[model samples]
Target: MIRNDIRALDAYHVPDASGLIKLDAMENPYPLPDTLRRTLAERLANADIHRYPDAAMENLREKIAARHGLAPEQILLGNGSDEIIQMLMIAADQGACAAPAPSFVMYELIAKWIRRPFTAISLDEHFNLDADRFLQVVSREKASLAFLACPNNPTGNFWAADVVERIASDFGGLLVIDEAYAPFADRDHLHLINEHVLVLRTFSKIGWAGLRLGYAVGQASLISELNKVRLPYNINTLTQIAADVLLDHFHVFDEQATRIRCERERMQRALAAFPDLQTYPSQTNFITIRVPDAGQAFAHLLKKRILIKQLGGHALLENCLRITIGTPEQNDQVLEALKELFK
Candidate 1:
């Protein structure tokens, strides 16, 4: 029989986005160029399916590290950042897992699966963290691990560097700075990595979602410990080969991200012009807005074959919808749909 907690938990839901414009998930809207797609196909075709993947993935690690100017020894791979989050929770010292409320949900959900205590420090009305208060809770709860999503999801705003670094310096525990949106952000905090701090990232949002690849950058010893908890052959042979080949052409993804950022700005400006909508400035490829009626707007978009993430149930995010930036045509369609609803 399953544990009562496990039984009581509701399974995570991924709504059917089939036949919709498909902006519910924050994915790169652009597809690989035909040439690159053919190249990747050729590389993947050469992979030996009979053999297990490169468990250590040394070459891939070196390639990823070189991009960040870190050593291969400092890298740890996971099927995706979610797997890495679970590994960190499983390997950390026995104590509470902490994070700011209204941030990523996985930190708390995975902690619960492990039966670890979880603490959420609520953000202020403006969705900003108070560093001093966060540390106070972490210390009082004796939290041994924490996760902070940079340019936080759902809200799509980056916290001040001083605020984040202060928590990293004062907290006596493992701290993960998740930079899943780093490619779209104006800054990164790799310089803060140390014994108790790690930066997590995923290629999913950057256009390799189908590959399910993620990684962590930390001090060599810390990464080594997290590696112990990773499942054997977690990344398959095909994914490994594809990732290795794709990293060589990372400029393609970078260019796509630049275009998304530009679209995000354009979308922000357009959304702000609506008198009934309140838009938050974003540093990621998504924009979150508080609309006059989230339900109405969401339904309107769906009727028009569009899909977006409606983040309800949280007081701070009430009547809010998170819109992933898409190509020019997709964005234009969204604007037109909203205009029809509000007109």
Candidate 2:
């Protein structure tokens, strides 16, 4: 039987996006080029699916490490960042877990599943983190693990680098600086990694989300410890093949990211014209806006066959809706719909 705590928790919900514009999730709006897709198909066809995946994934790790200027030994792969979060929760010392409230939900959700003590420090009214205050709470709770989602989701902003560095240096336990949105951000925390700090990244937002691949970089010893808890063959044969091949054509994804960044700025300007809405500055590929009525705005967009993330209920995110930057046409359609709704 499941524990009572597990029973009390609601399962994670993913809205059905069938036939809509499909912007509910922060996914890349572009698909692989025909040539690259065909190449991947041929490669996948030749894969030895009859055998298990390469458990070590040495080549893939090396490719990823080279992109970040690190060694393969310092890299650890996971099915997705979610699995790595679970692995960290299980492998780290047994004590309280800490993170900023209104950050990544997985950090708190995984902590709850394991019945570990969890503490969430609230962000200020402007969604800013006070480094000194955060460290004080971590010290008081004696938290053994912490996670920071750079350019945090739903809010779509990053804390100052100095603030993050101060906490990373002061905290005694393991600190995870999650850069899931780094591909779209102004900077990353990779240089902050040392004995007790790790940087997490995913290819999902840039592209290749279907492959479900994510990796972490840290001191070799820390990665070695986390590797023990990782399930064998966690990344399957198809994914391994696809990721290795895709990294070779990384320029395609890099160019696409540049396009998205440009589109994000254009969208920000368009959204600002709406007097009824307040838009937050974003370094990520999405924009979070506060509207007069998020529910009505969401429904209005749905009527126009668009799907977006409506982040309501949270105190800081009240009346807020998150829209992933899409192709120019897709973005135009959304802006038109919003203009109609507000008019």
Candidate 3:
């Protein structure tokens, strides 16, 4: 029999990623160029399958540390950024309390999974963090773990950095910053890693989505505790090697990210011209737009085989749709489909 919390929990909803234009998940739609794919295939062709992965993920950790300009001791790798979130909640709650928001789904889900007392602070109408409100609730409740998504999901807007820093300082608990979308944004609190905060990042967005690699940068002491709870061999040999290879070629993806940023700006500007639609300024790779009758628009896009994230019931995001920036051609197709729908 399932635990009461497990039974009461809403099932995690993942859409059918089978065949549409597939933009719903905030994934990089560009496939690896032929040369990179061939290199990866050749590298994996000789990987030692019989042996287990390095439990410490030493090499991958080093690569991440070098890229982020931190020491290896400051980084803790995860199966994905999701696992880093779970690890932080477990470490902070220690089987007791977790606090997230109405916008982020994982913090609540994971808290429930761990059977912790979870509380949600609602966001303002613009999907911005109500810092005073959030701090007020956390202070009164004395929650030990707080999860905030910068450039928050579904809404695609970055909450102010100073506000997050204030929370971390004032709240004597673990403050987790899920920066899964940070690369696309202009501001970040990575400098806050030295402070009372833990930052999570993933290769999934940059260009290594299939590798399922994510990591947390925080104080060494905190990272060690998380390491203690993580499953041994959690990250496999192939993933470790693949991540190392990609990190070596980091500039390839950096160039791609630059192009995506350019395309995202252009897409946002173009979408703004359409009447009856309000596109939110995005710091991440995606943009969230308030459409007139989002359900009808979502369904209409589906019919045109153009998929985007529908944020119908998400607190301040009602009637909003999130669209990830794809390659130039893919973006053109999405814009064309929208024009057809609204024309």
Better of 2 and 3 by TM-score: 2
* Model 1 weakest lDDT span, ten residues long: 309-318
Residues 37-130 of candidate 1 have per-residue lDDT tens digits of 9999998888899888788999999999999888999999999899999999999999999999899888889999999999999888788999
Writing each residue's lDDT as its tens digit, candidate 2 over 236-340 gives 999999998999999999999999999999999999998899998898989999999999999999999999999954699889999999999999999999999
Predicted candidate 3 versus true structure: per-residue lDDT over 73-125, tens digit per residue = 88998888888878877777543343444456777778778777777887777
The lDDT of model 3 is 0.81
Q: In candidate 1, residue 199 scores what lDDT? A: 97
Of the two candidates 1 and 3, the one with more favorable lDDT, higher being better, is 1
| Cα-based lDDT for every prediction | 0.92, 0.93, 0.81
Q: Please report how far candidate 1 places residue 35 from its true position, in Å.
A: 0.3
TM-score of each: 0.99, 0.98, 0.95
